[model samples]
Target: MPWDLRDGEPVIDPAQVRALLREQHPDLAHMPLGEPVRGWDNTMVRLGERLALRLPRHAQAETLLDREAAWLPRLASQLAGLPSGTPHHAIPAIPTPVRTGVPRTGYPFRWAVVPWVEGTPAVHVPLEVRDAYAPNLAATLRGLHQPAPEDAPASAFRGIGLADIEDRFARRWDALAGGLGRERRDQLAEVWRRAVNAAPYAGPRVWLHGDPHPNNTVLAGVGPGPMASSPVLVDFGDLCAGDPASDLGSALLHFSPYGREAFMAAYDAGQVPDPALWARAQGWAVNYALIFAAQSPGEALRPLGRGLLA
Candidate 1:
């Protein structure tokens, strides 16, 4: 059931919103409310109305989502083909009014009311299904890295790179005992440094859905063209423009060698990436997995974390 937006007590609890859905959009509200999708970084609620509400679980998310809104359009030319959670002008950062009886001034964290793309998040699909899946995902990634014009519009965000990321992990590790043993951590750190050195690509810059997790991927009924039947990418809050490999967290960390081959074959069928950069992508995938771990305590992201570490 859809949320019946009407005048009433300020909706304070998320449960209250669910209640409104039941009272209003019975067809949707009653179907089944999946457990609230939780991420240490954010909270998500799936609306029965073919949409999802993304509530930034923290203040940092406000900046990230805002950046996404600003940057995605620059890559619209290529993203139109891949649309995996690409930021849309139609979606608004609608704050769920914090209903405090008399009506409080604002809602909880910065939030966005997003369109929910149908299909499952790619968390635990079998290896067999992956053969078909990886290519689609690769095609989407290809579209993301498509060459852009020299004079084309670009993203305004000028923020941290792999170094800022390294610092984050270093500091986070320092907060713990032993700090990820010298030898192994050093290897990871060296890789991180290499990725940093290899930053700022000279290749044509294009927008990427900075965080394209299995959860963020959703299969839309086949659309059109070579890439049409694949899962449509969704979740654009982390979108950015840069070396496309920055988004290959899955290929390097999650996909098997065979899976990687299939994905790469599809992604690089006609175009090839700088070999040096592709190596850097391996490091990015590892770091991305680690960085992503700090965002949530879910069994879903665990195997990917283990794979990256391995």
Candidate 2:
């Protein structure tokens, strides 16, 4: 139950992180450890200017960190050689792990030192200005959807067919129905049912970022107007191989109708998706919204949850 809702997970401050570094990685221990960037799963401490130390705040995040350590290097190597006209080639950049650390002293889980990627999280970007970055986001997803190696991690509930998680979705949908408008609730129900019945992805398994929400995507320079900007995709904790539709949830959850259209347009420009894929993406959106509502309802992600249901 790593994903289970809990407020009592152990905390790792700069002092504790410094201690771990001093004991296990003294070369990095001398570098300044900046304030920690707190997230639901991990607390990332900026280690000097170029690297970040990511430590799990919750038990479940350990497995995800290990997944990233095992898979990202292989994925990064393939990204450069992907087809030229494909979205993978269009991605701005991705984080590279400098070193992976094992449990030591006060820290009881695996951790990593990754290159600190630049850009603003889509959540921090204003709604009025988000349309400009949609296409870049689409390209990042398209790039990440390349076929994974045979031994890539399997995320049972993440990148799998929507039908596989339908029951879990139904329960969360029931819980969320209480606070939503009847119209919105009805719309969500219809969207979920249609997606559940739609033809599942019949293509070969491709890499999925697992969680492609706004916070995970970092935009470098999001200038104004309709001008597009390439965004760097980060936080590969949920990396797995499965339906590409599962990874497209961020476009709907983070953008306006216009932005959603722009994203699909950019994605189709490279490789057109089956129309049915939209239905499955919508279902994955529901899954994301409901999970946030159930686990951390007051979180910033809840705003996107409402948008997804809307």
Clash totals for all candidate models:
11, 1
- Candidate 1 Cα errors over 4 Å, as ranges: 1-37, 68-106, 146-200, 219-229, 292-298
Error of 1 at 232 (Å): 2.9
Deviation in angstroms for 236 in model 1?
1.2
- Weakest ten-residue segment in model 2 by summed lDDT: 221-230
TM-score, prediction 2? 0.89
Q: Write the per-residue lDDT of candidate 1 for residues 1-310, one digit (tens) a residue.
A: 1123224313435575465454434454554445455454545677655565555545665566555454555555334544456432112111222111111134444454455666555565544454557767776666565554455343332112455466555664454314356787677667766766774556656656666766666654432332234566666666555666667744544467687777766666655546656656766676656654544445576566655554
Top candidate when judged by lDDT against the true structure: 2
Quick one: how many clashes does candidate 1 have?
A: 11
For TM-score, the strongest prediction is 2
CA lDDT, every model vs. true structure: 0.54, 0.77
lDDT tens per residue, model 2, 271-299:
66677888888888778878765655456
